[model samples]
Target: MKAGYLGPKATFTDIAVQNAFPDAERIGYTTIPDCFKAVINNEVDMAVVPFENALEGSVHLTTDYLFHETNPPIRAEIIVPIQQHLMVHPMQYNKWNEVERILSHPHALAQCHKFLHNQFRGVTLEQLTSTAAAAKYVSEHPESNIAAIANELAAEKYNLKIVKENIHDYDFNHTRFIVLAHSHTEILPSLTSTYEKTTIMVTLPSDRAGALHQVLSAFAWRRINLSKIESRPLKTGLGHYFFMIDINQSIEDQLVKNAIEEIESLGCHVKILGSYFSYHTQK
Candidate 1:
């Protein structure tokens, strides 16, 4: 299937998509919102969008797009381990001392926060839209004082130099991504019932003290454990909102079906996009 991800190319989001949807035709878009919009417009089969990062907290724009805007639901979730490397033009800067300004996507730079502070010291930091974009800029700028923090794939893509290796402070850093599709065809061929988590979105009839409790109690009463829950405002209405939740039980289970039916019976909207574990949702 045709899959789209955030990029100009070689960004962490693009790398996540590539790792998650290995065999699919991988296409890169410039922004996360554009990737989501492509799915809404049916420009691609499913678009990979990063929802949150271990270091940067959340992709609020992505959350907003998925919740506030009228669009297809998130069919699946993918979690990609984040690893970053520093790349530069060797012809211009042969050594770390040759660089004074480092560039990267804001999140990437943030993940490698300690690394940058200790190594670069007082060097200037330039924030770009994506790591690939930063590499692209470094490729065109030809400045001995410039370097970029990006994936090794980006270094190969741009033929940039690698002055450092695995500079991210934590090796366990991971970014969670979600796949957007036209409703029916969200999961890939390898994705089956073996998945450990199912992500879904719901909208309540009205906001009240026990409004959330009643819906959550449906799952709790059924003995289905929830892993995550988040809410974002509705675009058309000032106070109206929607929610995204993760439950341990897959949607294929009878209990999940029953809970969903009960949730809808409460005059709310229930949308199950897809069911899959974190690892396979990439791309």
Candidate 2:
């Protein structure tokens, strides 16, 4: 099987893909939408895309594309612990004191906030498209006094040396990546039985009294546990938003199906995003 991930290589998303499908043929796309497009166009058998981060919250591109662009079923989920390391070109000054500028993706840079403030106080922080992109830049500019905050895999991939390890501010940092395909059963029949989550997009009844309350009541009366519920604006007009809800149980459950049907009966629109299991990997 072939798998595509967001990359120039060595980004957190790339690492997750590597962990999940180590033996599959791996391909890298430049952006989140590209990965989704690849799955829709069949450029690859499957695509791994970052869905959410423990520290930074949901990846907007991933959420938006999954909700509006293409509604591919999520086959599985991979949870990867994130560790950002400070790396520099081998030929550049080895000492951390020699670094004048820090480079990484914006989210990665933000994740190392305390480290940047306390250690590299006056240094400049440059944002790139991806942490791997920053590593590539530092590797190419050997004479420059720049360091990249990326994963150890990035250091190995770019032939750079890690000067500081685990520079991220938090120890519990993790990013959730989802595997998407045209059909889960077609991609991997065994995974279908592992389904544990049912995500749905809900648009509530407009100008109706207790509309939001009624929506929650639909699930509450059925005793269906909600793992997550977040709102995103519809963008068509003011005060128009949709809720992305995750039911703890699989969509195949009769109660879960009935609860969703009841939600729709209340003049609300519902769309099932996917029903899949979460896969956790140890570092």
- Per-residue CA lDDT of model 2 for 136-172, tens digit only, reads 9999999898899999889999999888889999999
Q: List the residue pairs that clash in candidate 2.
A: none
Q: What TM-score, to 2 decimals, does candidate 2 have?
A: 0.93
* Pairs of residues clashing in candidate 1: 17-283, 20-282, 78-281, 88-161
In candidate 1, stretches whose alpha carbon ends up further than 4 angstroms from where it belongs are 186-196, 203-207, 233-242, 264-273, 280-283
Per-residue lDDT tens digits for candidate 1, residues 157-275, read: 89888888899999878888877787687466354324577777898887776888899999997899998898777766787778888888778899998999999999888777556
The TM-scores, one per candidate, come to: 0.84, 0.93
What's the TM for model 1? 0.84
How high is the lDDT of residue 168 in model 1?
95
Q: What local lDDT score does residue 11 receive in model 1, on the 0 to 100 scale? A: 76
Question: Each model's RMSD to truth, in Å?
Answer: 3.2, 2.2
Which 10-residue window in model 2 sums to the lowest lDDT? Answer: 185-194
